[model samples]
Target: MAATALAGVALVGALVAVALGTYGRSHTPTGRPLALVIGFTDMAPMKAWLATAGVLLGLAQVLSAAWMWGRLPIRREAPHWLGQAHRWCGSLAFVLTLPVAYHCLWSLGFGTDSPRTVLHSVFGCAFYGVFASKMLALRTKRLPGWLLPAAGGLLFALLVGAWATASLWYFTQPGVPLK
Candidate 1:
C-alpha cells in the first residue's frame, strides 16, 4: 500500500514536471512581463519582493515541520497550534508563488540563454511538481514517514533556488527600480 501511494505521488509529480516543461519550452516567450496580476508599476521588483515573502514563509514551514517531526534541536514537543501554523504558512507561500510563476512562464517561458536562467527555469518547474507530491503525500495513506519531509524539503530548496536565480539576482542588479 505504501509503495502504491508513493508511486502515485511520484507519477503525479513527474507528469506535472513534464507538462510544464513541454509547455514552457514550446511556447514562444513575449520577452516582457505579463499583466497577470497587475497593480504595480514595475513587476520585476514586485515579483522579487513576493518571492522573498514566500521564501520567508517557507522558512517558517521548515521550522514548524522540524518541530512537529521532533527533529528540532530544542527537544520540546510541538505546540498545539504548530500544525495549523505550518499548514497556513505553506498554503500562503504556495499562493504567493502563483503570480510570479504566471509572469515567468507566460512572458519569459523556459529560458536557456544563460546558466542562471536555465537553472531557474528548471527549479521553477520542479517546485510545483514537488509541491504537488508533498500535498499528495499528506493525503496518501500508509506511506513512509520520510516521504512527506523529503518532498517538502525539496520543494523549499527548489523555491530558494528559483528565488536566488531570479529574485536575488534582480535585487542585486544595478539600476533596478527598488520602489
Candidate 2:
C-alpha cells in the first residue's frame, strides 16, 4: 500500500514539473510584485520575509505533528489542540507561499541559468506536487499511518530546500536590499 501511495506521489510530482515546464516565459513585466507584502520597493525583501515565515510555520507543523503522533517526550496521548495547531500552521504556511509562487510562475516561469536557480525551480514544482500528495493523503482512508508523516516530512523538507535556494541565497548577496 505504501508503495502504491509513493508511486502516486511520484506521478503527481512528475506531472506538475512537466506542466510548469510548459509555461512560456512572460514577456510582460512581473505583476502584483509584493502586493501581498506591501510597501517593499523590490520583491526580494518580501520574498525573503514570506519564505522565512514559511520556514517557521513549517517547523511548527513538524513539532505539532510530533506531539500529535505521541513521538514527543510527553507522557500523555495526543492532545486535540496539537492536531489543530498542525493543521492551521500547515495551512498558513501553504498560504504564505502563494504570493511568491505567483510571482515566480507569472514573471519568471522556470530558468536554469545557474545551479541554484535550477534547483529552486525544480524544487518549486516538486513542492506543489508533494503538497498535493500530502493533501490527498490527508483525505485518504486505509493507507498505512506512516504515510501522513512521510508526506508531511517530504513537504517540509522541500519547503526548506526551496527557502534555502532562494531566500537564503538572496540574503547572502551584497547589500541585502529591502527596496
Candidate 3:
C-alpha cells in the first residue's frame, strides 16, 4: 500500500511538472509584470513582499514540524495546538505564493534568458510538484513516518531557492524602489 501510494505521488508530481513546464515554455512572455495592488506601487515590490512573507512562514512550518516529529533540539512534546498552527502556517504560506505564481505564469512565462531566471523557473516547477506530492502524502494512510517531513523539507528548500533567485535578486539590485 505504501509503495502504491508513493508511486501515485511520483506520477502526479511528474505530470504536474511536465504540464507546467510545457505551458510555460510554449507561452509567450508579455514582457510586462502583472501589477498587483497589495499595498505596493508595482508588481515586483508586491511579489517581493509576498515571497518574503512566505519564506518566513515556511521557516515557521519547518520549526513546528520539527517539534511535532520530536526532532527539535529540546525534548518537550509538541502541544496539540501546535499541529493546528503548523497546518495553518503551511496553508497560509502556500496561499501567499499563488499571486506570485500567477504573475509568473501569466506575465513572465518560463524564462531562459539568464541563469538566475532559469534556476528560478526550475525551482518554481519543482516546488509545486513537491507541494502536490506532500498534499497527497498527507492523505495517505500507513505511510512511513519520514515521508511528510521529507516532503516538507524539500518544499521549503525549493521555495527558498525560488525566493532567493527572484525576490532576493530584485532587492539586491541598485536603486531598487521600495514601493
Candidate 4:
C-alpha cells in the first residue's frame, strides 16, 4: 500500500512536473498567475531549478497525504517503508519549499508589497517550520504536541487570509487618492 501511495505521488509529481516544466520553459500568459509564469521564466537557472523543485516537493507532500489517508493499505502493512517514504517526502518537501517560498517572497513582490504577501510569507514559514519539527519529532520519537496542529491551522488560516486579500484587492479603501 505504501509503495502504491509513493508510486501515486511519484506519478502525480511527474505530471505536475511536466506541466511546471513546460510552463517554466515557456512562461506563457496563463491568466491564473502572472507571477508564477514570470517567476518561472525570468530568473533563468533559478527559475528552472525552482520549477523542478516545486514538482518534486509537491510529489513528496502528495504522497505523504495519500499515504496517511490510507489510500494504500499495503503501505500501512509495511510500517518501516511507509515511515521512510513519509520521512523522505517531508525532508525533500522542506528543502524544495524553501526555494519556491523564497522565489515568491524575494523574487516576486509577495514578500513586501502585497497584503496577501504577509500571510503568504508568515504562514509559509510556519508551515515549513512545523513540517520540519514533525520530521524531527518522528525521527526522534518525540513530537512536541502543539506543533503539528498549530502548523496546520496557521497554514490554512493564512491561505484563507491571503485569498481574502486577493479577492478584496479591488474593494480595499484607498489610503491616498490618485493625484
Worst 10 residues of 4 by lDDT: 162-171
Which sections of candidate 2 miss by over 4 Å? 1-6, 24-37, 76-78
Best-to-worst ranking by TM-score? 3, 1, 2, 4
Superposition error at 131 for model 3 (Å): 0.4
> Residues 1-179, candidate 4, lDDT per residue (tens digit)?
54454344335434543443334334433323224433333333343354345445555555555566565555444354666776575566456545554454443433434556555445444444444434343334333444444444443353334333432342344652211
- TM per candidate comes to 0.94, 0.86, 0.95, 0.41
Residue-pair clashes, model 2 = 0
Q: What does candidate 1's lDDT look like per residue over 31-136, in tens digits?
A: 7866653555588878998899999999999999999988888866899999999999999999999999988888889989899999999999999988888888
Q: How many backbone clashes does every candidate have? A: 0, 0, 0, 3
**Candidates' C-alpha lDDT:** 0.89, 0.80, 0.89, 0.44
For model 3, residues 1-179, the per-residue Cα lDDT tens digits are: 88888889878887887778778889987867765766788899899889889999999999998898888888778999999999899999999999998888778888798999999999998889899989988898877888888889999999999999999999999998877
Candidate with the larger TM-score of 3 and 4: 3
**Model 3: CA > 4 A from native:** none
Ranking by lDDT: 1, 3, 2, 4
Model 2: per-residue lDDT, tens digit, 1-179?
Answer: 76786677667767766676556243443544545657776787888888889999999999888887777898988876777787899899999998887788777767577999888887787888788877877776667877778878988998999999999999889888854
Candidate 3 lDDT at 136 equals 89
Ranked by TM-score, the better of candidates 1 and 2 is 1
Candidates 2 and 4 compared: the better one by lDDT is 2
Candidate 2 residue 163 Cα shift, in angstroms, is 0.3
